[model samples]
Target chain A: MENFTTKASAQPLKNADELIDSVETFIFDCDGVIWKGDKLIDGVPQTLDMLRSRGKRLVFVTNNSTKSRKQYGKKFETLGLDVSEEEIFASSFAAAAYLKSIDFPKDKKVYVVGEDGILKELELAGFQYLGGPDDGGKKIELKPGFLMEHDKDVGAVVVGFDRYLNYYKVQYGTLCIRENPGCLFIATNRDAVTHLTDAQEWAGGGSMVGAFIGSTQREPLVVGKPSTFMMDYLANKFGILKSQICMVGDRLDTDILFGQNGGCKTLLVLSGVTSLSMLQSPSNSIQPDFYTNKISDFLSLKAAAV
Target chain B: MENFTTKASAQPLKNADELIDSVETFIFDCDGVIWKGDKLIDGVPQTLDMLRSRGKRLVFVTNNSTKSRKQYGKKFETLGLDVSEEEIFASSFAAAAYLKSIDFPKDKKVYVVGEDGILKELELAGFQYLGGPDDGGKKIELKPGFLMEHDKDVGAVVVGFDRYLNYYKVQYGTLCIRENPGCLFIATNRDAVTHLTDAQEWAGGGSMVGAFIGSTQREPLVVGKPSTFMMDYLANKFGILKSQICMVGDRLDTDILFGQNGGCKTLLVLSGVTSLSMLQSPSNSIQPDFYTNKISDFLSLKAAAV
Candidate 1:
């Protein structure tokens, strides 16, 4: 196990061809690396193709739980990429995988405070789930003689990135955690801001999860980045060693730290929310193993070397 | 200045007649001490009548921001208690008062993430406001080529106990705080939970505020209890002193801590969310100066003394 506590001095990976040669598998974070919102990043498809030709296994690990693996596969197709659903390890899938890993009772239902992705993933996983986009229009009117109620069958509340997030969902999730005995509070991820568009920042899943944390006063069992659940799941299912995997992402807190926590080599890219000043700031203690302009820099650097 | 850091041994105030006689003003927390939901606590009207008869100035200080001082005054009338609007200092009113104290520019508009009480309070305080119940039905569809827009005129975003809390409000607030230069984030109160009904726990203002905190990654300027903004407002507006005021309430974290933070004599009533076990627990560091069954205990203890 690597001592992640001691920060690795992030060096420029532009000249480090040997580092890339040693890795058999590459784990990617979507949104910033593959594309920025609706548009694909330049040279992403070519870089991925090059990696595929070199017999390197690729896994798309996204903290955005708004889309399931199937949806992500369609998105890849729309972006002119040939990524498959089998290689996409989205956070939405992680929630279902987490429940399956624990051998959750068949009768015990899950309450979702997310989007269609979480609901669809849970359905595919054969778990009875309720309360996601359906609860979007629900209102808790504190009228005279009004009483709030919760479903007793709710064994776990899965919180994710929800654009339809409202008070009813927040209160419902709160009730389950506070009232239900041994009810698990699970968070997809705690990313502060996500690249919703190439133009500006958008509130992430952490904002929705924060409401539950504040109301219930309980920390959630996060199933997304920085959590070893996905890493262990991938290791068991795909038979990949941590040393052979390199985690490439843009964010320091979630993406870069996720790799370091999973004992995988980390590469920080500057194409997303992070900047060079932010990466090198003394306050930023989470240092990645290598730094580059973007994932496509692999192709650019290799071409320049030739 | 009283050193509230050292825990004061909370004594049963059943026989503390002198403490009652010395207090010229009594600040009461309405929810647990006066009423539970719409039902008035036993002998609450009589207790207030007795306090008024003794020439004690009564002020209702509530952390619940769902109601403005005027709305709270109406609630008092509905409960058969004669608490005028002047006597009520709600957290919503505190938000408006905070803006007034800061001498906020008249041209700037305020964005609200709360109930009508906050909107009404801001209106009464002579501030232009938008985005409360109106934004409840709004949705952020992450469709192809979608863009989220926010008001540039928004100078402050006031978050309170909002039942209509949704992702639109969360995203707009996040944008204003993160994108706009020096845009203030104001929270009415950060109470973990509120007694929406005597039956169960309802998510409080903190839950809504937590969304903004998580998304914006900025600490809000809290104007509610334990912030001292309301305390100073009451002192200046009503010519009251902390020494002459006895703060009575049910919740230890909010009401009791608010009193202590304001340097007022504190009393904890067991009629609300807290239990005797929770209060007496060694881990409970927030000790009130006194403890009793409820506000009606003042009368019961007096009768027992006779």
Candidate 2:
């Protein structure tokens, strides 16, 4: 709803070459745009190799907080693409980076309501943490008036994509925020509709975030795709202007809106979550700069192919 | 907020005898009014006995679904009070009665996101149920794209005070409501704020209920305090007019508002969660018909004492 420019009309690329010529940096969303489920989409490796041959700076930006950047870096090799851990910026990485930027205390621990990815990142950033799935927090114990334990060292409560979220974890996080004075409530992502598979779309990590928000009546600092935090982090670290970057993603809400928020051009690919009809729908406020059938469609304009 | 009347001003009980004379039925809220934490309040047994001797029908109604009415009956005996299981109308009891009233199918099972109370009540009513603390649902397994299994015979999903509520249970219950056609979503309570101790107020079963509601975007048939379901059930079975009943509770929100909704007299007791300052605050909408420092304050006017 902000005063932002769309690409005049949502149309097919007439000159993909002209758009490609204008952008030096390419930001790609991982889930649907690169791969569907565990399998890589067709022409992904070739597309990455082609983009690199053209001397374009490629970066993989994902809202998946379940995996560390290191884990995601390994995923690139598994998908037959050569990429560094530095180029992969997951929500967990963004959360750790943001915490580092704010000069979060090394002595203080963060209580976690997420998976191992966020934990790994925080550890790499030199932070101590407690209460994840591995802890006894996830086990069922329904005794009357279950005493909620607390940690004095917990300075922040971080929530991400946690399959292991339970009453005790929520209670732990709520108590940490309420009981601990000046405790920071941080969420890794806020994707409303996350795709499990092409057909199955269950509630995302945002629902977990929304639960805490509802109970504590507090807002979380979401350091994910749609938030401008990632964009700022990317720009500051890479020394690239926002206008020099173009975001390519499958989902409209997080990926497209994220690019729009950063003043970067966005390309919506149909190989993932968003259908072509979603882009055509006039009710959608988040419109991308261009629409294509697949991420591989840009391959037609590649100089290496010619 | 409706066309209901307030006590105008929370005044001191000048004529306790006169206020006590109006209602034939006495409904008491268990947790703060009768008992504080695990221990029964001082003079609770004596006051209850005196009220019963006065030819007043006494009933214990609570939103807590952790213990069954039979279990609650044992607690009453432990606390040195003569209370029958029939005299207790816990949320679990209410849920069972409501299901019986609707003639819930014995063939269909209810998926539970709660404790043993509702499970016991449902079993007593000859209804099948699955998934509680004892069931394997509350434990966490963070495998990617974990397939959500479903019970084809699940006709309803019941939520209560689940200390073991996790993502899988929430998702399982959600899938039952969303995927299974005509599957009812039932909640034992909708307590906005519940506490273990007076000093601590954490997210209650309502927060667990809220997670499913937020995910499925479905409203549940709430069967607890502040809802008219228990009032209707008590009125029909006991053959007493709503006006004949007087509700005594510590909290203004659930107990007082429930009494007000049923057109019954409400007595706010200071022996529990609601403080005197809370009643005096104009910001609070619910007000009691009569207020005393403690439930035992009426003992001063008792004939046994006289």
User: Per-residue alpha-carbon lDDT of model 2 for A1-306, expressed as tens digits?
Assistant: 235555565677656777788999999998888888778999888887877888999999998887899998998888778899999999988889988999999989899888889989988999898887675355435356656578978999998867777767777788888789999999888665555544456667776786676567678898997888999898999899999999999888788889999999889888887888888888776778888877777777554435
Across all candidates, what is each one's fraction of true contacts kept? 0.61, 0.25
Model 1 CA deviation exceeding 4 Å by range: A1-8, A141-143, A303-306, B1-8, B141-143, B303-306
lDDT accuracy of residue A300 in candidate 1: 73
Among the numbered candidates, top lDDT falls to 1
lDDT of each: 0.86, 0.82
Docking class of 1: medium
lDDT of 1 at B246: 89
Residue range A81-122, candidate 1, lDDT tens digits: 999899999999999999999998879999999989999999
Pull out the clashing pairs in model 1: none
Q: Which residue pairs show backbone clashes in model 2? A: none
Error of 1 at A224 (Å): 1.2
Among all windows of ten consecutive residues in candidate 1 chain B, which has the lowest summed lDDT?
B1-10
